[model samples]
Target: MNIDRDARLEKPVITANMTPLQWANTEKYWTLYKKESRISSESDRTTHSLTCCDQELRDQLFSIHDDIFEMNDVNMLKRIKNMAVKSESVIVAQVNLVRSRQNPEEPIRSYYARLKGQAVICVYTVTKK
Candidate 1:
């Protein structure tokens, strides 16, 4: 299963609650995304269903395509929170699983950032091995 010589390259892409325009509200937002550096990973955390209201977020979780969406609890939905998506020295990444379907009981990784008034989520999911 040596994957290093696949002769394929993945195009670099970014993700957020809505579109690139929506994520660029401030320099801080860009900085935040740079930290996470992946679109699907960021979407799983900060947005309900990887989208806000009516905006259709990029479905980077799947190589094919999906419209899977998730929502926060009423409490999390109503509160103001700061969010950041990135990898860290201690953590490899924020969102590990961005798939077309998920079990409701599956645990998704997320963090509460107070400044952005939202929880940073990483729906790192595992499939049947």
Candidate 2:
């Protein structure tokens, strides 16, 4: 399917404060949209992805990074993911993970899955020192 200007496709808006899982979901959704819409052109994909991002995110990218407008879709998405995993956001994710709990009526499997999702944002590493 060539680019359909009239297609009622809702793009996923990426935000500056989005968590790792949220970012992953956004990327997945974008991929699905591309596949479903049969959008193969790199330029079209990049333009659509960037246009879906929130204003703050777009501004931040434009300010700190040069040649973003020339970037391909994969590179631009990678840059956005990197920005989201900064120190401040990681700290916030750790705090959220620490405070996470299952709701009263939630099942064990669902609770476990939720906790796992929350944990994805809290980067874990082992120091060789």
Candidate 3:
């Protein structure tokens, strides 16, 4: 069978569920959202990026407000933020521990060993990059 394809058919169709007002606002929000500051920390960046998706769009995306995907995303973001804050505290503690002087009664070998271990842990666990 031979059929003539209308050129208009090549264009995208607006989804029936989304209204014109919602679409316009979403487009405007997206443009403004992209101009926001870029974060250096991975966790901060993730939080910032996720927040850019406006609530209106989110409501349109998931029929249920308590959708599993939404819940998981929120939980993951919270975990990332917590990890970043905790890692910062850990790094500071390790630095202080490494800097403290050994007691007069402590052996020089033991002091060096403790410092080396702390240094290794800091280097492996709290990398900023």
* Candidate that would win on lDDT: 2
RMSD of 2: 5.6
lDDT of 1 by residue, 1-129 (tens): 433444432322333333212333433453444344443553444453223322222333322233233334222222211121222321222223122233465444422122122212332346797
lDDT of 3 by residue, 12-107 (tens): 112333432333444444434433332355465444534544464344444433442434434543432332222434567477765779989999
As a whole number from 0 to 100, the lDDT of residue 107 in candidate 3 is 100
| Candidate 2 error regions (>4 Å) | 1-7, 85-101, 107-109, 119-129
Please tell me which predicted candidate would have the highest TM-score against the true structure: 2
Better of 1 and 2 by TM-score: 2
Model 1: worst 10 consecutive residues (lDDT sum): 110-119
Give the runs in model 1 whose Cα sits over 4 Å from its true position.
1-47, 53-57, 64-84, 91-129
lDDT tens readout by residue for model 2, 3-119: 576775687788877756877678788887888777899999888878877888888888988999899999988888776544447788789889988899999999998888777
Ranking by TM-score: 2, 3, 1
Query: In lDDT terms, how accurate is model 3?
Result: 0.45
